[model samples]
Target: MDPDVAMWLGSTLLTIGALAVGVTVHLIGLGRVAPTFALGLPGRRLRTDAATFALTHRAATPLTWLAAAIAAVAAVGALAAGLGTGIGEWAVLAVLSAIVLVIGLTLATWRAHTALGDDALLDDSTNGPLRPGAD
Candidate 1:
């Protein structure tokens, strides 16, 4: 097979995979299922119905979108790299895309955690805690 054609095919596959993974992650993060239950095993129960869940979902929405954006960009990069002249460029693009994927996810999770943090919830003097017993 021609190198360029092979590269393009590889890029297309990567793009599809990235999109699948990104969408899956976003759906999981935005879901209301209990984390332990999601893992398919019994574990400590958490307040899944709390206000924190809503807040976290709202906070995470943008992050998930950002992740999607990153994935799209990666896809574009892959496509462009495949069309470009050098194999070295393709390698670089692959590494960069991987880095971007990791970084985007890390930032998204971090932001969501901060937004739904105990302090953030506690600071809401009007609504107070989501659960009556929750600290």
Candidate 2:
């Protein structure tokens, strides 16, 4: 294969991979917290504090949005690179940065999810609205 074609293909694949990773991580993080917002019977609902749930949701929302933005930029860069009009170095840099951001955000979300679950079980009084009849 021609060197230029090889370079373009490699960079494009890298960017696409980064985008996929970011999106997958974001979805998994959101799913982890989804049970907290369930609308099932109070007895069946997951125990969680309202304040902590809100805080975690707030934190995760921004991170997910940021990941999406990074993915979008990387996708665009990849497309441009494939067209032979974009800088290969920039595409590679974008992919690397996106992967780093996604990893960091995933870790943070995991911590928040863990804390939310722990707090709910540890503090009986602050079970939020999920457990309506608990004494």
Please provide, for model 2 over 1-135, each residue's C-alpha lDDT reduced to its tens digit, 9 standing for 90 to 100. Answer: 765566566656655665554555444334333433342112221234443443444335555556556665665565565466545665575566567556656755664565455644344565542332222
Question: What is the TM-score of each predicted model, taking all chains together?
Answer: 0.60, 0.40
When summed lDDT is taken over every stretch of 10 residues in candidate 2, the lowest stretch is 37-46
Tell me the whole-model lDDT of each prediction, alpha carbons only. Answer: 0.56, 0.49
Model 2 residue 7 lDDT score: 51
Per-residue C-alpha lDDT of model 1 across residues 1-135, encoded as one tens digit per residue: 776776677677767766765565444444543343342111122225444544454455566567656766776776686576566677678667767766766776666566655465564666564442244
Best by lDDT: 1
Model 2 / residue 134 / CA error / Å: 19
Single out the weakest 10-residue window by summed lDDT for candidate 1: 38-47
RMSD of 2: 8.8
Clashing residue pairs found in predicted model 2: none
